[model samples]
Target chain A: MSSITWQTVQAEALRRIRTREWPPGSRIPDEAVLAAELGCARATVNRALRELAEAGLLERRRKAGTRVPLNPVRKATFEVPIIRQDIEGRGLVPGYRLLTRAVEPAPAALLASLPAGSLPPGAQLLRLRALHLAGDAPFCLEERWVNPLTAPGILVADLDGISANEWLVQNTSFTGGDIAFGATNADAETAAALDCPPGASLFVIDRMTRAGEALITSVRLSYAPGYQMQAVI
Target chain B: MSSITWQTVQAEALRRIRTREWPPGSRIPDEAVLAAELGCARATVNRALRELAEAGLLERRRKAGTRVPLNPVRKATFEVPIIRQDIEGRGLVPGYRLLTRAVEPAPAALLASLPAGSLPPGAQLLRLRALHLAGDAPFCLEERWVNPLTAPGILVADLDGISANEWLVQNTSFTGGDIAFGATNADAETAAALDCPPGASLFVIDRMTRAGEALITSVRLSYAPGYQMQAVI
Candidate 1:
C-alpha cells in the first residue's frame, strides 16, 4: 500500500543472513533495530524472515526471535532415474550386448496376458538375454518380456549399441507401470554373470512398463548390493 | 497360467522360501526339474520363479539358477510431511496451542503473491505460533502463515483438536513446493518452547505450499536433532 520496494529489502535481509552478519543460533536484531537498520517497517522484516523460514533457511519463534537453522533434512529430493540417460550422464559409453536371443513358443500365461486371440502362425516368443555393463563387469542382466502385438519389430530390432531404457524413453511414452523394489541373493548364474559369489546380496527392481491399455514390457533388474540409491531427503 | 495349477506352484515356492526349505543361498531346481516335481509344466515353474524373483525371494540366472536371499535391505521411501502427522505417526499426541493469531498488513512480496488487493479488506495475515509436544516435552515449534483469501476464517480455524497436517491433506491438494532441510541451534524462545538449552541441535524443515497459482501457506518446523524419518523404500 505504501508503494515501497520489497525485493531490495528482501535481498538485504538475505545478504545479512548469508554473510552471517547475523550469525545463526543468534537471534536477528529485534524488530525495532532491524527496522531502523533496513530503513523499513517491521512488516518488511517480517516478510523477509517469513520467506526464509519457509525456505528452511531460518526459524522464527515468539518471545525469542528469528534465527538460522542448522540442518535441513527433507530438503533433499529424489532423483528419478532413466537408466540409459543415467549411464551416459555418469560419463559411460552405453552399450547393450545380446548374450542370448531366441524365439520360442509363448509361455501360456504370457499369452493369456495378451488379447484373447488364437496364436498366429508360428506365434513364437522372443527371448533376449542381455548384459549391461558399465565397463567390463556386468551391471545388469535383463530378462525382458515384450508382447509381439505391441512391439513386433523388437524381435529383430538392432540393439548392439543401444539400450531398451533409452530406446523406449525415446520412441514411446508408455503411460504407466508398477515398480517394486527389494533385496535378494544372487544365484550362481547371477553370481558369475555379475561377478559376485553365490548368496551375495543384490538390489532388485522389477518394473512392468505399460501403455494406455497395453502391457509394454516386464523387466527384472538385479544390482550388486553395494549399489546405493541415495537422496538428499 | 495352467488351469490355475500355477497358483499352487507359487504357493509352494513361497512356503519353501519362508520355511527355509529352499535355504538361503541354495540353488533352486530349474524349470524342467521343478515342473516335474510340482506336477506342472516347465512354463508354470518358470512363472513361479519369476514371481518369486519379483518378490525379492530369489535371483534366477540363465545358466546358474535361483537362490534364496539373506538380507533384504528393504527399500525405504520418505514422503514430504506435515509436521503434526509426522509427529502423531511416530506415536505422539500432536498437540498445538495457537500462541497468536491476527490479521495484519500483508508484507509486500506476500501481498504480490496473494489475491489482487491490499491484504484484501477483511483479509489479515494469520500468524499462529503453536507448540507441538511428543509425550511430556515439546517436540516441535511451528510458526505458520495462512492467507485469509485462501484460508478464509483462519482466525477461527480449530487447530487445537486436529493437526494442521491431516486437515490440509483432506482439505486440499497442493500444486508444488520447495523444501530445505537442515540443522539449527535453538534460540531462547525455541529453547524454552522445545525445552532445550540454547545452542542445542534441532532438525528444521522450512517449506512453502502452493495451491494452483497462489502461495497457500508457508511453514517452519523445528525439531530435536534426534528426529528421524523412516520409510519403506
Candidate 2:
C-alpha cells in the first residue's frame, strides 16, 4: 500500500471483490475514503475503480456510488486480424484468388449502412469477389465494395494475387468502422467455392469503414464451417 | 485550436491521418511538440494519441515515437448482455424454463477449461439445462455447470421460474472469466428444444468464470439459426 500506484490499488481492490469481502450488491466506500485508506491520490483510486467497472466487476452511477455488479456479464475481446496475416500466423501458407471484379454503381446494401452524403447515389465503386485460403484448404469467401473516392487506386489495381480485404487495409486509411459477427447457411455458390455442402453453417463477419465523411469500404467474409473466435477475459 | 481538450486533439489528429496529411508509415511530432502547438498539456496529447493507438489508427513505440498504422485493423466493441435483459429490451416478453437439474461429478469439459486446483476430481457439482424464450419463440438453449463449493445455495434453491443463468448472476460473484464464440451444428436434443432442424447452424457462446482460485461456473449458450451480434466501432 506504500507504493500506491493504480496497478497496486487495482490488485488490492480486485482481491477484495474476488474473495467476496465486498460481496455482490454491496456498495463499497467512495473514492475519497478509499484513497485515504490506501494513502494514494483520488485519481489513482478512481482509475482502479474505473477499470473494474469497465471489466463488468463493478457498477458505478452518480449519487448511487459504486457497487459490485449484481449480474456480472464478463467481456471477452478478440482481435480482428488481417486475413493474410491471420492465416500465415497459424503456420499455414496463405493464398488468395480473385473470383470476380467490376466497377459499378453503389449497391443497396452499401447505401443503407453509411451516413447521408457519405456515398451519394450513382457513385461508382469497385466490387470484388474473392476467396482466401489457408494452405490448400478454403478459408473464407469475401465480397467487398470499394468506394473510389477514398481509395481510387482500386480502380486500376491488379488484384490477381492480393485480396481486396488485404489490399484495402494496406492502401486506405479509415477514421471509423463497425464489425458484425453472425451465422449463416451456405448457398450453392458459396458452398461450391468453399467446398462445403449446401446449407452448411458458416461463420460470417461483416465490416464497414469510413474515412472522414467518405465511406471507404464494406466487406463480408464468410468462413467455412467450424470457425471459432475466442479470447481470455 | 484554442479550445484544446483531448477530444479536440484526437479529432484533429484523426482528420490529419485520414486525409493523408500525416500519412501512414510516417512519424508524427512528439507529444510535447504537439501539445505546445495545440496549447494543451502534454498529458492531453498523450491521452488523445493513446486512444487512437487503441483504436488501431496509430502505433506508439518507446524511442521510435508514434505513427499512423500502415494497416489499421479498426476495433469494434460489443457488450455481452444478460439474456433476460436482451429479450426484454427488444420489447418481447422474456420467459425461462429449467429443463433439467442434477448434482453430479465434474465433467471433463469443465475440468479442462478451469485452472488447476480448481474443481478437484470427484467434486459434486450442480448441473442445469434450461431454455430462454422471447415471446414464445425459442431463443437459446443453455447448459451450465455450477461449482457447489462456490455456490452451495443451488442445492436448495427453487429454480422453477428463474434460470440458472440469471439465478447465478444474481447470487454468485466471480473474479475472472473467459468467453468463446463459434458456429456448431445442432444435435437431436438441442434441435428439438430450439425447434430447428438437425444439423442446422447455431451460434454458440462458451463461457467460464472463476472466483479467486476456485472455478465458479461454466456454461454454453446456443442460439437458434440466424443470430447476429452487431456493434459500431
Candidate 3:
C-alpha cells in the first residue's frame, strides 16, 4: 500500500470497478464498511465519495444512500461580468463613449425593489444611461440609478474617458449585493444599441446593493447575446 | 438623530443629488468627514460608499477619493437559479422532467477536463442527454456523463420516470466546484435540441465539480436565450 492513504482508496474503488466486482448501479459499501476494507478511517472513504459525487462519478442524497452513476456528469455554471475587462483580458483595448445621461424619475419597478420609504416625497432619482463599445462594436447598454439622498454627489464626472466599471473600481467599492440574471428577447431600445432587431435574445442582469446601512445603488445591465464571463478558480 | 441611520445618510444623499448640491462628477466627503456629519463610524461610511460604487453611483480609489457618478446607475448582478420557485414563492408548481439519455465516449475536451488517467483505458463513457421540462415546455436540455469506475451502480437506473437532477441529488454529495457562465453561438446539434437555429446565440454554462480527491464531473449546459434565473436576498 502506498504511504498516501486517500489515493489508495480511489485506486481501490477503480480496481473494484474494473474487475466488475461491484457492478454498475450497485451501492458501494458505506463509509464505515469501506474504511474497514481499506484499513483507513471512514473520513477518508467519505472524502473519496464526496469528490466522486462532485465529479459526477457517484450520487447521494439524505436518507436515500449513495451509488455509482450510470452517466456521471453534472451541470456547469459560468460567471458574467463587464465588457471592457473582457476585451482587455483577450489583449484588446477597452473603449467607451456615453450614449446618453439624464436625471429622470425612477421607474415603478425600481422604486418597488428599493426598501420601502427610501426616498422623500417627489424625489427625482438621478438616472445615468450609457453604451459600452468594444472595437467599434457596441458591447453593452447600461442604465443605472442613484438615490441622491443616499449619494449626494453624482452629477459631475468625466464620462468621456472612463467607464463606470473602471471609475467604480478606481473610485469606490462594492461590499455586498443581491443580484439576478436572465436571458430575454431584446426590446426595441436594446436592439437599437446592439444593432440587432428588437426581439433578439439578450443576456440581462439586475442588481441592488446596500452599503452597510445605506442603500447605495440600483442598476439594470443588458448585453448582446454571445458575451460571456469566465472565472477560473 | 434619525431612526434610519445609514439609510438616513443614503436618503439625504439622494435629496442633495436631486438639488445638485453635490452635482455630477464632484467628489464627496471621505468616511471620516461623512461619518462625523452623519454621526456614524468610518466603517459605516465605507460600507455606503462601497455599495454605491457597485451600484455605479460613486467613484473612489486608493488616493482619488469618492465622487458622484456622471452616470450613476450600474449593472446589478442576480444569481441564476430556477423560475418556478421564484414565481411560486408567490405560490406555483416548481415542476421539472427528463428528456433523453444515451451513452457515448467522452469527448476529447471533456476528457482533458476530467482528471487525467482516472479511468482505465478504453472504457466507453456514459452520456445521458436529458431535457428538463418545466410544466409543459422544454426548460433546459441537460447532457451529462458518468464514469463507471466512480460509481458502478449507475448503469441500472431506469431514468424514464426519474430526472437526473432528482436522481443525482438522491445519490451523491459534493463539497464545492468551479463554475462558468457565458453566451455562445449554438452549434447545429445543440440548436436543434434547444429549438433554435445553428449560429443563433445560446446561454451556456460550463462547469466542473470535485468529489473528494478526484474530479468526478464535467458538463456543458446550453439554454435558449430567454431563460433567466432570478434570486432575492
Cα RMSD of all models vs. native, in order, equals: 23.9, 2.6, 11.1
User: Which consecutive 10 residues in model 3 chain A have the weakest lDDT in total?
Assistant: A72-81
Give the better candidate number (2 or 3) by DockQ. 2
Descending-lDDT candidate ranking: 2, 3, 1
Supply the DockQ value of model 3: 0.17
In candidate 1, residue B186 scores what lDDT?
Answer: 63
Best by TM-score: 2
Ten contiguous residues with the weakest lDDT in model 2 chain B: B69-78
DockQ of each model vs. true complex: 0.02, 0.60, 0.17
On DockQ, the candidate that comes out on top is 2
Cα lDDT tens digits for candidate 2, A57-136: 89999989999877776655567888887888789999999998888999787788778988877998988899999999
Give the candidate number with the greatest lDDT: 2
Which stretches of model 1 miss by more than 4 angstroms?
Answer: A1-77, A91-93, A104-125, B1-233
> Could you tell me how far off, in angstroms, the CA of residue A116 lies in candidate 3 after the best superposition?
1.9
**Docking outcome class, model 1:** incorrect
Model 2 misses residue A171 by how many Å? 2.7
**Residue pairs whose backbone atoms clash in candidate 2:** none
